[model samples]
Target chain A: MEYKVQVIVKPLDAIANPEGKAVERALAALSFDRVTKVRAGKVINFTLEADHPEKARSITEEICQKLLVNPVMEYSEIQISQSGN
Target chain B: MDPIIKIVTFPGTNCEYDVLKQLNFLGADAELIWHQESDLGSCSGIVLPGGFAHGDYLRPGAIARFSPIMEQVIKFAESGGPVIGICNGFQVLTECGLLPGALSKNDRMRFICKTVSCVVKTSGSVLTSAAVAGQTLHLPINHGEGNYVCDEETLKYLRENNLAVLTYTEDVNGSVEQIAGISNKAGNVVGLMPHPERATDPLLGSTDGQVLLRSFIEASK
Candidate 1:
C-alpha cells in the first residue's frame, strides 16, 4: 500500500503566523488575484506493506505522532491508496 | 562550598564547551553532563547550551526536552536551584514546560546573525543581577526560532512582574514585545536567545556580556 500524508504546520491559535502573513503579502503583490490567505505546509508520501487499511492508518498515525509532524505547531492528514497489482 | 555548574549536553548541542569554558574562566568549575543522566547531585547550577539538538528533527528543542536529564532539571528548578538556557537550550526550556511560551520561526523568515542591543527590563534575575533598569548591552544572536510568544494575558503578566529580562532595542525579529530573554516568576530560571558567553571577552571586541556571567557567579554564592 502507498500512503500520502499532508501535514499542516501552522502556528497555534495563540501564536502568530508571520510566514503566512508574508505569503499573503506576496500573493497580493504578485497579483495572484483572488487569493486571500496564504499558508504553507508539507506533504509526505511513502509506501508500506500492511495487512489492511485500518492497520495502515494505525501505523501511519503512530509515525505522525512520533516524527511526521510536531503536534505543537503542525497537524497531519493521512490518505492511503492501494497500488495496482 | 565553592559552586560547581554542570553544562547539559544533548546529542546535537555545540555550545556546551563554550559555556563550560566561560564559566571556568569566571572561577567556577563547570562539567559536561550527558543528556541521559538522571542525577543532578553534583552541581549548584545547570546550563543547557545552545545548538540544534536531535538535529532539530521535529522542532528546535522538541525532542531534546523529553530526554531523561530534563526530568532532573525540572526537579532542580522546582527546588530553587538556578538554571540558565541559551539559544536552542532556551527553546528546550520552553518546550519542557520549565518556561512559559514558545520560540516560533523568525518573522523575517531568515536566520539572523549579528550583535543586537538588549535592554534590561528586569534587574533582579540571577542572570541580570548586575544590570540596572534601562541598561543596554550588545550580544550576538544566531537562530531562526528566536521569536518569543505568549498569550495576551500572560504577556501582560510578564510585563507587570518585570519578567522580561532582555528586550531588543529594535524589531530584529517578530518576537512579541521584542523579548530577547525572560525569567520565570520565581526568577530562578532564565532563558534567552542571544549568546552571552560568546560576548564575554575583550578579544571578541565586546566584554559587556561579562556582567551576565558575573551575575550568575554572584547568585550561586
Candidate 2:
C-alpha cells in the first residue's frame, strides 16, 4: 500500500522561537494585537510504500526521529494516511 | 609523514578550498573529499568547512547529515581522530548528533557577517588545544541560524564537562551562554559557527584563526 506522510516539525517549547516572535511583532504592528503567541514550524510531506498502516506509521516515526527532526531542539508529529495509487 | 587532513565538501559547500589553502600553508596535506565518497582513505583528520550545504534546505545541515561521507566522519570521530566543523559544518555535526545542541535562527532573525571576539573557554578539544583558557581570538561569523540552543540538562552537562570550547565575548548570536563553539564529550569532534579558515590571513584582518587551525593540525598529527 502507498501511504502519504506529513511531518510537522516545531521547535520545542523550551526553545526560543525567534521567527515566531518576529512574526508576532509584525502582526502587532499590523494591528492584530489580540494574538498572544505564535510558534513557527515546518511541514514535510512524502509518500511511502508500506505493508500496513501500522508499518507506515512506524516508518514515518523512524524517519522523523532520524532525519526530519532534531530531537535536541525540535519535535515532530507524524500524520500518515493511505495514498490512492 | 605530513598528516593528511580531509576537508569534506557537500554539494553547496564553499569553504573547503579556504580551509585547504590554510592547512597546506600550515604544513598539513589538506585535501577535498566529496560528500558521496564512503571512505575517508587514511585521513589523519576531517574537516567540514562552512557553506550553504544542500542550499540549507530542510534546515541547515539536516539534509547533508545523511551524506555518504558522514558515516566515515562519525567513525573517525569515534576513534578519536580530530574533526572540526565550522559554520554550516557545525550545524551538520549537531544534526548528526556528533555534538549537542542546535543552531537556530538568530534571535533577531537576520544573517550576521562580521568579525567577533571569542574567548577560549577550554583548551581541551582538538580545535583549542593550542590555546589557553581565557585567551581571546577574533574570528568571522557568517550565518543566519547561528543562535545555538539546547535543553537545560545538556547545557549543564556541557558546562560541567568544559565541552563549551569557545564563547562570544558578547551575545553575538544569542547562543546559550554566548557559546560560539563546543566539543563532543571525547573532545575529538568540535563544532563552531565562526569561520576560522577565513580568518587565517593577516590580509583578512585577523590571523588569530591560525591558533585554532594550528591546534587542529597538531591534534591530527
Candidate 3:
C-alpha cells in the first residue's frame, strides 16, 4: 500500500497560541471534551510512492530525519493509507 | 603560553577565517582544522567557528555533529579543555550532546542578520570572564535556526549552575529565557548563537567581542 506522509517544524512560541489556549480552556469548561493537550503546529501534506507499507514507513522516517523536518523543535507523525498502487 | 588554538572547520563551514583573524589580532595563534581529520593539535583551546556546516542539511548541526573532527572535539572537551562554539557551532555542540537544549528555526522563520545588543550573564566561563552581568555588547547574528529552546526545569538548572552565558537585550529570536548562550555542566564547553568574531573590530561597530576571546586566551593558560 502507498502512503502520504507529512512532517512539520514549528517553534514553541510563548504567546503565539493564546487563541488555541483559550479554546482549549473553553472545551474543558464545557465538559464535552476528553482533550488533554493541544499545540498549534504546521501541516506538511505530501504523497509518498513506495512499494509496500514497511518500505513506506522506513522511507517516511528517513525523509523526516533528512529533509522533511527539523528534529530540534518539531516532532513528526507518519500516516499511511492506500493512496495508489 | 600555548600559541595556537585549534579551530574546527567542518565541510561547508565558512567562518574559520574570521575566527582565525580575530585570534591572530589578539596575538594568539589559531589554525583551521579540517572536519575530516582526526588529529587535534596540541593546542589548549578549541573554537568551533560559525557557518553552514554540511550545508546545514540534516537539521542545523545534526550531520556535522557526527563529523570526524567532532570525535576529537568531544575528547578535547572531555579532558576539560576550553571549547567555544559560535553560531552554527552552537547547534553542533548541542546536537552532539556537549551542551543542552536546541536551536530551532527563528520564531518568525527568518534568517535574522544584524548587530544586536547582548548582556553577559555568566561571569566565570572561558568565554565571558571580562563580560559582567548587564554589560552590553553588539554582535551580529545570521542564522535561521538560532532560537534557543529548553525545558523549564532544565533551564532552571542551567541558571543555577551559571551556564546560561548571554541573553539578547532585544528579542531577536524566540529563545527561552532570552538565552543567547550556554555552557556545559562542567563549564568548559561554551555555545553561543551570535557571531562574536564579527564584532571583534571597531571598524565593524564594536571591539567588544575581543573580551570573549581574551577570556578564552586567559582561561586556556
Candidate 4:
C-alpha cells in the first residue's frame, strides 16, 4: 500500500518564532486587529510504501524521531492516510 | 608533511575557498571535499564552512546533515579528530548531533552581517586553546538563523564541562547566555556562527581570528 505522510514540525512554544511574529506584524499593518497569535512551522509531504497503513505510520514515526524533528527545539505531528484518499 | 585539512563542501556551500585560502596562508594543506564522497582523503582536520547548504531548504542544515559525507564526518569526530563548523556549518553540527542546541532564527528575523565582539569563555577546545579565557576577538557573522538555543539542562552541562568556548560580548543574535561558540565534550568538535576565516587579515579590520584558527591548525598537527 502507498500512504501519503504529512509531517508538521513547529518550534516549541518556548522557543522564539520570529517568522510568525513577522506575519502578525504584517496582518496588523493591514488592519487585521483580531489576529493576535501567529506561529510558523514546516510541513513535509512524502509517500511511504508499506504492506499496511500501520506499518507505514510506524516507519514515519521513527523517521520523525531521527531526522524530521529536533526534539530540543521543535515538536512534530505526523499524519498518514491512504494514497488518493 | 603538513597536516591536510579538508573543507567539506555541500552543493550550496560558498565559503570553502575562503577557508581554504586562510588555512593555506597559515601554511596548512587544505582542500575542498564534496558532500557525496565517503572518503576524507587523508585529512587530519575537517572544516564545514559557512553558506546556505541545499539552498537552506527545509531549514539551514536539515538537508545537508543527511549527506553521505556527514557519516564520515561523524565518524572522524567520534575518533577524536578536530572538526570545526562555522556559520551554516554550525547549523549542520547541531542538526547532526555533533553539538548541542539548535540555531534558531534571529530574534528580529534579520540577516545579520557584521563584525561582532566575542570573548573566549573557555580555553579547552581545539578552536580556543590559543585564546585566554577573558580574551576577546572580533569576527564577522553573516546569518539569519544564528540565535543558538537549548534547554536549561544542556546549557548547564556545557558550562560545567567548559564546553562553551566563546560568548558574544554583547547579544549579537539573542543566543542563550550570549554563546558565540561551543565544543563537544571531548573538545574535538567545535561550532560557531562567526566567520573566523574572514577576520584573519589586519586589512580586514581584525586579525584576532588567527588565535582561533592557529589553535585549530596546531591541534590537527
As a whole number from 0 to 100, the lDDT of residue A68 in candidate 2 is: 83
**Model 1 bad stretches (over 4 Å):** A1-7, A13-36, A43-85, B1-3
- DockQ each: 0.30, 0.72, 0.15, 0.81
lDDT per residue (tens digit) for residues B85-174 in model 1: 999999999888888877888886789999899998888888999888799899999999898877777788898888999999999888
TM-score of the B chain in each candidate versus the native B chain: 0.97, 0.98, 0.96, 0.98
Q: Model 2's DockQ?
A: 0.72
Q: After superposition, how far is residue A82 of candidate 3 from its true place, in Å?
A: 12
lDDT of 4 by residue, B78-177 (tens): 9999999999999999999999999999998798999999999888999999889999899999999999999999999998998889999988788999
| lDDT for each residue of candidate 3 in A1-85, tens digit (9 for 90 to 100) | 4577665645344423333555677888999488755556566667887888789889878876765555545667777676755
Candidate 1 displacement at residue A84 in angstroms: 12
Overlapping backbone residue pairs in candidate 4 total: 0
RMSD, every candidate, angstroms: 3.8, 1.5, 6.7, 1.3
The CA lDDT at B136 in model 1 is 89
Q: Ten residues in a row with the worst lDDT in model 2 chain B?
A: B1-10
- Quote the lDDT for B207 in model 2: 95
lDDT computed for candidate 3: 0.81
Would candidate 3 be rated incorrect, acceptable, medium or high by CAPRI criteria? incorrect
Say which prediction, candidate 3 or candidate 4, comes out ahead on TM-score. 4
TM-score of chain A of each: 0.76, 0.95, 0.57, 0.94
Kindly report the docking quality category of candidate 1.
acceptable
Write the residue-wise lDDT of candidate 3 on B122-155 in tens digits: 7768899867876888888888878888777778
Candidate number 2, chain A TM-score? 0.95
Candidate No. with top TM-score: 4
